[model samples]
Target chain A: MELLGIMLAVLGAALAAGFAGSGSAIGVGIAGEAGAGVMTEDPGKFGLVLLLQALPGTQGIYGLLTAFFAILKVGIIGGEPVSVNVWQGLGVMFACLPIAIAGYYSGIAQGKTSAACIQLISKRPEETGKAVILPAMVETYAVLALLMSIILLNSISF
Target chain B: MTLETGYGYAVSRLRAMELRILGKSLFQRLLESDDFKDAIKTLGETHYAKWLSDDKGTQNFEYAISMELQEAYDEVDRFTPDKELSQLCRLPYDIHNVKVLIKGQILKQKGSKKRTDLLTKLGNVPIDDLILAVESEDYRLLPFGLHRVVPESLMLWEQTHDILSVETLLDSHLFLTMRQLVQKVGYKGVEAWVHAKIDSENVRNILRLRRTGMDAGRAIEFLHDGGWISKEKVLSLLSEPVEGWNRILGFADVSRVFEGVPETGNVDDLVSDIEKALDNYITDVLRPYRYSTFAPENILTYLWSKEIESKNVRIILVGIANGVDKESLRRLLRNVQ
Candidate 1:
């Protein structure tokens, strides 16, 4: 039972990381597609758009780190078999919540910013700085989500 | 707002929108294009062509870009509900328009043939009315929100003797207003960007002053009051040679752009690079709130993007018409996005 509990926790953490990463992957993929379209029209602004698209990708790393911490430091795997309890399940669920939510939204928002950045770069490859101002606005929340997930993981003793 | 509801819809919508931007390799192709006509043809075959009419000509590319930008801003604004944020989006253009109007006023007063035709497309303010207003109206002539600050800007400008000093003062005033707006709205990301812009502009102004051999006092007077440029730093750099000044300016990251230009040459490209740098910063660093309505940053980003796209197409078209070679035109390309 204890072994099953440990395995469950490890699985939960992996699940969290996988889902969050998927969200980021989808968001970045969309931005990449849009960026390709813009580049087809005006290739000169590629670097700027590429950087904007990268902003949404931060969440995937955050999710991975959270999961890694849970499994490694917290001994979610390769430990004494402890029966998986409701509290442990809730901990795993909530631990993944911030990143999953942040990743899902930030990915989409970053994509929009990337598209806008691509359009701006296409027109004014020189004024790419001005184009970046708004996308960075969206990046803040993603960062906050990552921070929250990290902090929550750190607090969990499981 | 709780996690379950607050920004749910907005985030989904924004995420959907983000998936639509362009990529890198295409930029190389556009840059490598032979001329503006070729660039337009290439773009016409892309997704952006949807925004353009089937009859959209290279001559009207910038206008089409502007319409697209306005539409993007509108969509963002519709998604967000912050009025102050919307107003902030117009601040940069407002300041740009003000500068254009002031320059026009001065030119018309001196009976110069060039009456600020560069900004005829903006149509935000009239040259004639601006002239009349500046000459006859008090600070009260300014919009209600800006009336109080007009006196401060006027005083700063009055104390400056040279053109550089006047320009710096005006910029300081505008920078202050932008900073205030960014702060009031609690948009720290945009705030950082605005500060960076002000810092870049101030550093550029200092470089111009050094090249002109202006006295230390005069140079200090010319410095924009509240940018990242420290007074002591500028004073120290004033005593150094061009390369030394470049090193200090390079520390600011904006100086690397002026590397090729002669110290005495026009700083036209510097400003252009600064604009590009700010745009890049905005696009990469900031992300709009998921459920929040579009703010000032969104609108400003949209507007700046359109303006640059217009300028790029114009340059490309003009180069094609003038029979400029692809290699030469490449050097002229703004190396931005």
Candidate 2:
């Protein structure tokens, strides 16, 4: 039963990292395609397009951080194994749910936003700052999810 | 093939290219220029500058324009993964070249001067292949249904000895092909535009037949199928008197075109006026796509707009060279702005 509790906790960490990472990969790939297209026509706007392309990558980092924290608290990395009850293990997995769901969706949404911004900047290079702000706004929800997961993980008695 | 999300990059690239398209003001500048040379000089200052050099005269401007159009089509072809989607735009040119080649071959048999110079090099089928197909009478090299249509058109011509019949046959085939392409693309806006275009062409054919004192029954034979309006409806509409046409087709802008024509009006003038009205109507139909962002409609609309721009430029250049009046040229040009 204690082994089951540790396995569930590990599963929670895996879901948080796996879901968010895949979402970021898809988002960044979409943005990169748009960036490459823009660069083909106007090579001078590379810096601005690159900035937009990198916007969706934040969710992956947030997801990884959450997974790292969960693994550390569960003592899967470096520390001695902590015996956890089934309910406590389930609690840790539940804590990751916010970031796992939010990060996955937000990453994809931010990618579409970034792609649109890249298109805008291609037409009007002077508006790069304004374009950056639009996609960055989508990142707020992702950050909030990360914050919620971190607070939940921290508050839980291991 | 399903249109994938891969269009993101191509659509963005098209959006950027849209900015470089010549506006009404630029065309106005070309029209207002004092003479042919002045107009040429003005055009040289535009995006057309690369194609124009000091030695290239107004006589070669048509060739230059054709080359530019071919380049634009090639660029669009390179951008899209679906070759058939891009080929849809070039189908008309292919049909046109085939018509010219076949006609030229027939004319050559009579020992006339071959007018191959008039054939455009802007189609999907190479000029050499078109020539070979026409000369050999085996059209396996031609794409779409033209391989069958070419020989069948020739055989029909031999029986009827009517060039107009042959022309009508080829036109119907062309529109049929276009309709199939639009259906395949599945873009509602483009499909609608193509349907409207076919209906307009039918209207024009009917009106032309009426002008020439041809019967409604004979006019129906020339009408192309696959338009928004049914053949039965077209036949019923054609049976009405000329003045009554306005009442039947009043919803279309084309109805207004037939309103003011005098009984003794010149055929050439009437045809030109009708052509202008149809051109303007088609342009209006496609105008909504100007705001469309990522769909195939944007690409289709851009290509249409570019073709119209090319036509307007040609009209201005040719009008200037021939000393055509500014007001008349303006009346003839389609508004792309």
Candidate 3:
């Protein structure tokens, strides 16, 4: 029974991190690609786009951290015996959900901002600060997800 | 309270105000005007005309815009009742007031220029009084009586007299205020957006300072105290030749458009470009969202959209008045996203 619980925990962590991080990776790539398009047209907004692309990357980090903690709980770190009930497994799964969902949508939004930032740069390169700001505005949700997940995990007993 | 009730009211109001934003035709028409007065006349035909025609028309326009912003903000407050949102809306007014006072003082030092252009009575300390006040007070790192500068900003400002330093202090304060507000509200979304804007603005300011033959030290002094670009990088950037636009451009891929500016040109255009860029950013980008069942997104969006319209009108009014060529005037009109 304990071994089964351990397996569930490990799998859950891997799945959570893998799926959510992948979404973030894809999202950041999309935003970066849009930024690249803008750069090609005007080349001056590189810094602003970099910041925008980076905002989406935070989602991936949140996923990875959650998965790492799950793995530790399952004793993946020291090879100690691990135990988890179904409730714990469910907790892990739900905790990872926010990043996966928010990351996917934020990536698309960030991509659109990257395109706009490019247009902005082409016309008024001096205001790249505002361009960097637009996409960061979307990533707040992912950060909130990471924070909430951490709190949730802390509340649960293994 | 239900999330629907909390979010519904503000979002609906924002959407309605959003509809009133200047469409492309107005931008195009104003762009076609020969000068600022012509542009102002055209603008007078819009909803903004009554305010523009007041005895102190310019001040009236500024106040009317502030009132419009306040109305949009009130809608947000009605829905969410967030104190931070109130503070956010009021911040620009606070800063504008300070800037006006400071500029007025600076000019007074050089002998008074007309104080009419500055927005006073918006709780902007009277220019003469502000000068007397700053002169009497001990200049702390950030200086006393600064409504916003926290300890860090005070430190930075105390260290440098460069305008960039003052800017850095303000930027830092803005970020600090924003971050704390986000944490307090448990709303990370708005915080991220605010930080990105600060970073972008920082990079732009650095380039502007550098282009104007200002040193990194001066830039640091003027650098808005908070941003992603560390002071060290700015120092190195200042050492580069004016022709080294590519080096600055390399810092962020989004900033590549800055490289397109003519190698030989007035720095004023760069300042205008930065202003226009910020305006487009607030209006065109950022999807609105609900957080903690409050409508921060709607409030900020409405506030920013209104600001862009007012700025566009101002551009038109000034252009038409100057009798500038229609083609040139059009090109000068900032794209308000």
User: Can you rank all candidates by lDDT, best first?
Assistant: 2, 1, 3
- Against the native complex, each candidate's DockQ, computed on alpha carbons, is 0.04, 0.47, 0.02
Question: What are the runs in model 3 whose C-alpha is more than 4 Å off?
Answer: A1-158, B1-5, B34-38, B58-80, B102-117, B120-175, B234-236, B239-271, B278-295
Best by DockQ: 2
- Mind giving the per-residue lDDT tens digits that candidate 1 earns over B1-337? 1122222233334434444433335445666677666777676665467656456534677555555555655665565435445455555555565566556555665797644544432323344554455567454656523455444545555565345545565556666776777777666556655665666655656666766888887677666555555666766777776556567766664455446543434455444444444445444334342223323344344434444555555566566667777665554544222
Model 3, A125: alpha-carbon shift in Å?
37
lDDT of 2 by residue, B244-306 (tens): 777877765556656655443566766777777776677767677655435666677767777
> Given candidate 2, what's the lDDT at residue A58?
93
What lDDT does candidate 3 reach at residue A45? 54
Q: What is the TM-score of chain A in candidate 3?
A: 0.82
Candidate 1: what's its TM-score on chain B?
Answer: 0.66
Give candidate 2 misplaced runs (Cα > 4 Å).
A78-81, B1-4, B54-58, B235-274, B280-293
lDDT of 3 by residue, B1-337 (tens): 1212333324433443455568779888777766555665666776666566776655445565555555545555554545565556455555555555555555666687836356643332344454454555433423223633533343454465455555555646555666666666654555655654665666566667666788555566555534445556545656676456457646643244445444436667655655455445444444445222124555665565665666666666555565656665555555543
